[model samples]
Target: MLGILVQLIISWLILRFIAKTSMDVLGYRINTTRLLLCVGLLLFTTMAALLAYALRWWFGERWGMNPSFSLLLLANGIWWNIKSVLFEELIFRGALFYLLIQWLGAKKALWLSAAAFGVYHWFSYEILGQPIPMLVIFLLTATAGLVYGYAYLKTATLYAPIAMHFAWNFTNNFLFSGGQIGKGIFVLLPTDTVQVGYIAFVLVQYLPLVLFFVGNYFLLKRFGKVYVGKQHQAPQL
Candidate 1:
């Protein structure tokens, strides 16, 4: 937690220095529209995740809800997830991405930021000794990063991606109990057993995330300016 706070502060300072402006210039401020968008995306992603879990359960995976709920535990989980994800977005999609846009064009910036975000997870996943293939994990995280980057690019606000990131993490970590980091408030399946094949498990788990990414990509392309044209200017709050 201390590390995350330190990283966030450093990221804020670096962004301010690089952009020659306040944090608002990096889309840190909030507004009604962005808030609404955030909420909508949150709900959408949560529903999508639940749907995936349901499909898995239907396919013979056993699931059971926790018998008791603790408000304190839920609050702590929310804080932890939000804090961790916020620090990441501020670094990968906030500071690094802003600089990349200036150096490369927007189109290049998008993929570059996404790739960096994916690569950033290599160390953590390695330390965790994730059973999934490294290449597969990299591709999955990179794809998620693309979705997040696209969200930031289109909305020009951290709210969209932050909400999406939080939802993804909260759903997987808290609601579904399938996350690599953090124990969930509820357990979706019996922790004692693995019911699905590893490859099938990965597909079922990540399909919604991939769908959300592809869906957002199209939405941004059709409705938002995702490409960095010559006339494009840096985003402002």
Candidate 2:
């Protein structure tokens, strides 16, 4: 918790120094329209992920409620996930992203920010002893970062990407329980058995992410113009 606070402070300082603006310039303030858009994206992405899980279950994937599930634990998990994602988004998409865009242009900033995000996951995955290969992990996380980065760019607000990030992480951790390391509150596949195919696992794990990217792309196309060009300017809301 202290670490998260420090990270937030550092992020705010850097963004303030580099962007020459208040924290609100980084899309901290929210209006009704932005609120609705964020909520809609959150629900859409979460539902898409749940749909993928349901499909996997229909195909004989075993799912059981976590016997150890506690409401307190679930609440704590939700708070932790939010804090974790908030710190990440604030640093990667909030501070570093703004600086990179100013120095390297938006195109370069997008990929660089995503790459940085992917690279940073190496230490955590290693510590967790993840079964997936490092390169594969990097690719997967980088892809996710791209989606989040694009969402930030399109909406010109942190709320969209933050909502997407929280939904993706929370759903994977709490609802589906099939993250890269394959642990969750709700088990989608029995880890003890070797019967589950790799393809099936991939579909269950990554399909929603693909849908999120595509779905968000269309959403932005329909509504992004209103928020466009507001990212670098003073807070409008």
Which regions of candidate 2 fall more than 4 Å away from where they truly are? 127-132, 179-185, 188-202, 226-237
* Cα lDDT tens digits for candidate 1, 1-237: 887778767767876787665666457677776777778777777776776877777667675665655787678778878887888888888766777876787768888887887778887667345646667778888888888887877777778888878987888787766666445566665445557678787788777767777766665555444433343642321
Clash list (residue pairs), candidate 1? none
Per lDDT, the best of the predicted structures is 2
Residue 15 local lDDT, model 1? 68
* lDDT tens digits by residue: candidate 2, 29-82: 888878998898899888876777677666666778777777876787788788
lDDT of 2 at 194: 39
How far does residue 183 in candidate 1 sit from its true spot (Å)? 4.0
Residue 44 in candidate 1 has what lDDT?
A: 73
